[model samples]
Target: MSERVGAGKSGRKKVRDGIEGAKVVELRPKQGAASDKAEQDSEDRRFIHRDNGIWRRKGDNPPTFICGPVDVLAESRDEEGRNWGLLLAWDDRDGHRHEEAFPRALFAGDGNEIRSRLADGGLTLGAGTSAKAAFLEWLASLASEQRARSVTRIGWHAFGGQSAFVLPDETIGEAGERVVLQTTEREASLFGVSGTAEDWRREIGLMCAKNSRLVFAASCAFAAPLLGLLGEEGGGISFKGDSRVGKSTALRVAASVCGGTPQNGAGGYIRSWRSTSNGIESTALASCDALLPLDEMGQLDPREAGEIAYLLSNGQGKARSSRTGGARSVARFRILFLSTGELGLADLNREAGKATKAGQEVRFADLPADAGRGMGLFEYLHHEDTPEAFARYLRTATGQIYGAPLRIFLRRLADVMANEGEDELRGRLRDRIADLADDWLKDYPAASGQVRSVAARFAMVAVGGELATSYGLTGWADDTPSYMAGECFHAWLAERGTVGRREEEQAVQQLRDFIARNGEARFERWVDAVTAAEAQSEIPDAPPGERFRTQNRAGWKRWVREDDGKSAWRYLLTSEAMSEALSGLNQRSAKAVLVERGFLLPGKDGKIAAPISPPGHKKVRAYEVMAAILGSDEGDR
Candidate 1:
């Protein structure tokens, strides 16, 4: 048995070879240590005395018991062995126990924080700087007998490693060995476990039946841990709609899968979108390899909203300079986020006066909250009569029974991975996802690669939900997860309009918007007939009919006779203007899209632009945009 020491007369023999009054914890090394190292280990564990689970130890000055009980548990180092720390265990006055890891860096400070942390954790240090310094020194001395020994490593977020699925607070799969979780500080509300598996499965889990959004959101939580397993990149799903539409409730449902469900925006498993860029990065790291539930898109700064979408979906953060002035790798993580907002990402970007890119759209797929059933965000209310009542019940149920399903699901995953190596598990998951996606895509045979990719993501969520159900954690039917996920995917696809040629569609929309906004004001009209056209340059001198002009002309417009012999308004744009209209797209490719759609009439030279002479201007070649741009033009101009 390990050596046990006591503090008072009942336990006293002598204080010889130790800090005076406290009984010497006999010099005994942990088993398996060499004689010399064993002797050293004994010294490392010196000065600790436990009295009925109370940690007490004497201070240096006056040889007094400055404080009762100082217990330092096992030491820990990061997996890379770069940072070292120790796990501290203590009991509060109420007999409640607590354990937390403190990095050595914390002790290197002025000792105030260490003492404060202990005090905050229910260990009140004795008065005086000596007591504080001496107490801290004694705690540091726990590492004094550092004989070279294999130290356990820690990770910030070790999920989906090649060998195991690990989390900062816990591991999902075989750890191969014990590893401590060393994470940055975050809010008290996040990542906390409460309630039981049965409680959650009975209440919130059962309520997910026939509820597509709830299941879809909850599945995203499960899918987070599987991203690394399936060799998938990080991304997210956004549920956007008006307030009281149950969007936040969906977020809370997803949040329940990971930990405690805080009231929306009060922040726990569900975080507010109102954070700085740095704060968002920290939040991402806090929820790494887990579902990051963000509430309220309206809260985020419009300018930063779209940028953060790219940031969260990209799986990394901004790099910073180390104190030494050298650049260090910025924090990176694998995260699956579920968000709720009054507006979708594209509209949010529009608020910032920016257009949403295709990649951004792919990274964060937006699904409308309205189910189109006249019941906001729900197809069937199950036992409830109204969506509001349903949402209220979910909020109450989730608050009671959250932070359990995650453990149950992860434990099952760990068990499976332990039996079959993680590699095999990953392969199995990939195969299942592929099979599920194939089934989901049977109707959209011509889906774009991007569409397929998004489909696979939704499919992954479905598979995770179904797997949880199969594990008996969710108590859901076998086909429920897939059906719910399908409902969401089809809704997103319909919102998107076309599965394939999304870029082409976007290009057409871009042109349409540009013309709609700029047509009359930016396009200079050409004077008809030869003499009037030649007189256009002499705007001040020419007759009113000949002096056609426009302010800041982007290009030109004219009542042109089409091949079909109908006179309609046509927009003419220079190569530069066309490029401007199709910013962020391949210039030539966008033009080809226009031609293919009969939106553009290419010249005989096979170039996008055709030669056109405007009044008083040189016959500068310009792209003749079809009158269809205006949708309908009858040469009234």
Candidate 2:
């Protein structure tokens, strides 16, 4: 039998045996109907659909669906014409809600993009490759709808108590016993609400009461919230000393009164001096009506040091330009910041070869970090292992028990103002501070006006501490705070010296230093000759009686006479030499000052140069400076 391929009625190829005339039937492939149904089910499972304007998972019904309630708070279109939305989403599992900025393109993209973006806002969607597409489609539809109206931006009074106080997590207001308004967006976390008022008193409050330096630092921190009401300008207090001396630790202790950590790591309260001015500006705003702690003054650039000090203390940010070249809103803050450094601002500038300005010194008042007696930044460690160990303990303890005292203080101040009236309370506090200032300045009768102002600032911090104690916030004896503050302020004043005389003393020291350094190398003096004849010939004779008879030259006679043994060794500095030696001052002015002070003698020609040596070989006009004036003692003056 010969086999031939033939088409069967079922459209299958068949083999026939020609000799036997018998045909064989073949089976054909079946249609994939079940596989198609399975794929359809998967696609349906992947795509998330919306029910009643809420997104629902594929298998979820009424009770099983996640109820996150992602609300579109506000919407805007960027320059690229892409829509952007600010969303406040709630996570039921975590019981936390966070605000996020979402772009429309993310929702319009694949499901993975949608899932990833929502996940960033703390939302987790059901997992599946096909589910992402459905979620993305649902998100896109949601984005197309009308956005919720933008709520009015609340005006926050950083320094004064108002109906509402804006915090990191919410806006706490006095609508009915301090309601938490969770709808407002917080741009910066100046203050927070954590722990309890009692916890703060136990941890940070008691610590400040025991340590005078910590008390002053914490007092400065507390003063920040009342700066506006107090009508005081913003400024910073720097604790400066050697490395590992607990300067930064003291600042951290102060920072704990608010929301900052005392640890020296990421997200800790201590800020570095190496940041740009703009970064510092933002930091100041973030610390509005609170404490701003800066660490490591040695890290700051010398050129920007003065500018940063002035900017921060001035309570304003550098004006910035917007995209359209228009002026952006200036960032402002009124705060009392604590800073740490191995060197004071003046010494730091001097090391960089820059002169320290007086204003810069006043702006950042430097207090010695070492409290003396081998205790760094502390008079006693409150019976802890060591200062370092105590500092470490504070760092840990404060991180947990912070942010409550500030709220209580504010609330108490508000209540006082409401019951007693704003002006009365302010006047009473002002009088108390003024009395403290008088006590500090009573002994410093000749204190400069600026010194009085600085003393007042220190007094304010002390008074604030006393007030906190009076309010039962700090568990300290009533009189202890003021007494310690006065003692500390007295020490600072003594270290600062007579303020108005600082410039004069510095100038005199500079002149003395120049003379001492170059006395042998640059100055000329006639030594005693081998014989009296030689000495007599080398010395110039008095010109005439008329030389001593010159008018308006009273001091000339005393220095121009023939040299006695005591005056014979006096150094003669020429006008050119004097100019070079006193380069920090005008040549003529320096000579006049010396003459007026009786250190130099005036000449018959109404000039300052006197003839101490034999008309020196070149007949140079020179002045005679008493060797006593060039001594190290003169420089100390």
TM-score of 1: 0.86
Deviation of model 2 at 280, angstroms: 1.6
Q: Model 2: residues >4 Å from true position, as ranges? A: 1-69, 72-93, 99-120, 123-165, 170-194, 261-267, 324-326, 499-501, 517-565, 568-629, 632-637
34-66, model 1: which lDDT tens digit per residue? 366554455533244446322234433234334
User: On residues 165-192, what C-alpha lDDT tens digit does candidate 2 reach at each position?
Assistant: 4454444434322222222223434354
Pairs of residues at least 3 apart in sequence or in different chains that clash in candidate 2: 46-130, 46-131, 47-134, 48-134, 111-132
Alpha-carbon lDDT of model 2? 0.60
Maximum-lDDT candidate: 1
Cα lDDT, model 2, residue 556: 15
